[model samples]
Target: MPHPPPLGDSAGQPGRSNRVLGRRGCHLPILPQQDGPAAPLPASPGDAKLQRAKEALRLAGHPGDPQSLEAVGLMLDKLAKENQDIRLMQAELRVILILPFLSLAPQAQKEELETLLRKSEENARLTEALQRETASLQAAQTELRLLREKLQGLGEAGLQRHRRVCPAGGAGTGPQGQVPAHYEGLAAALSTFFGSNGTFAHDRLSFVDFLDEVEDALEELAELLGVSKEDVDNFEEMALTQLEAAPWGR
Candidate 1:
């Protein structure tokens, strides 16, 4: 390597000079004119490392352009330099730790490292894909819930229309109006079980809790409708089976 330029002119100039190469051979911007001593280097390990790399590159006749191999050499050189800096020691330690493994099978080292790199890249790609899938699943669940609400609203509207056309408590009707006796009984039971406010009034329930609520509510409804416990249990089982058969449920 060529000898670095002298820190200053041998004869010395009229004004004092303060210059240091930044990382990647970049000429650090000139500091502001100071009345006194120059500011100290960054105290942070990361910042100090970056500064050292740049200074090393400048000494090697390379501008601090990190993209260049010369700049990379400066950084690698820092890690190899004899220093008590904790950060540098850790970097060297990592290299030292891996040396035994690399030397054990020099011929296969390249292949093994390449395989490890490929697997790491694949793991990153899979992690990103999984995140996107999770977002899509959440969106789908929201849409499904909204659709269920709309369907319930429409069903209620249809029942209202039926009541308007058919007089309440008519010869063939239940006391609760044109709505069937069983449906009315079930509705009352649902209101009691679900806080009597409305369906899904509370948003804090977990999925398991919601399922349990549905089961208990159904039992209460069956009792009100004079339906057998066995029948309700069988219906619940069938509903779960259908759910498992659906792609989303799975």
Candidate 2:
């Protein structure tokens, strides 16, 4: 095998010394080519004109018989037309492949949109239900408060009745100018009960339970005042009769 020839050497050119510096700073020898078949030179990458010519020849894809300007121009034109046809075919094929997915796109979008709408409707319904429940709870709380106030008013009225009958330093007394110790005790008990346990007292008693306690207190008052059961019944009947007789009450 023959060693490669030096740079700038060709078949026609005579040998000449190219004094290149080696890695060790010595002058390297560039020998001339011995007679035989000359090796094909490697194309330089930086030679843009050469590369373009070679690429044109490759695309031309035919022997350069009777190589002329006209012949070369005709080959390159044919190659350019063929490349254009290939690119058009590729573009058409891309459109063909993508068409099916494009056709189904609307249905997919519709399903997604319907799902979102359904979710939105469900959220609205839940929100409405929550609002209704909140309003109902508030109304119930208000009604309960009014009932408690009414009960408290009734208790205050009972206390006032006891005070009027007793008067504080025994000013006016029932029948005789005398006050019963039991009657005084009952008044004291009423005061103690109302004073300690305020309106909405501890234990959170229900309206019915609180009314039962009021009834018990009234019974104690009647007993201590020495009022007969018949008198209490007559008084209750008379009160009811008066309410029924009134036009507003009826």
- Candidate 2 global CA lDDT score: 0.60
Give candidate 1's whole-model lDDT.
Answer: 0.61
Tens-place lDDT digits, model 1, residues 1-250: 9975555533665453466566886555567676988788758867866777777666666455545656667568657664548777898999999888877866677898889999999999999999999999999999999999987886666556444544466665432324333444444544433443333454676647767876786677545444445656654554443334212444
Each candidate's clash count? 7, 0
- Candidate 2, 98-142: lDDT as tens digits: 888766788878788789999999999999999999999999999
Query: Clashing residue pairs in candidate 2, if any?
Result: none
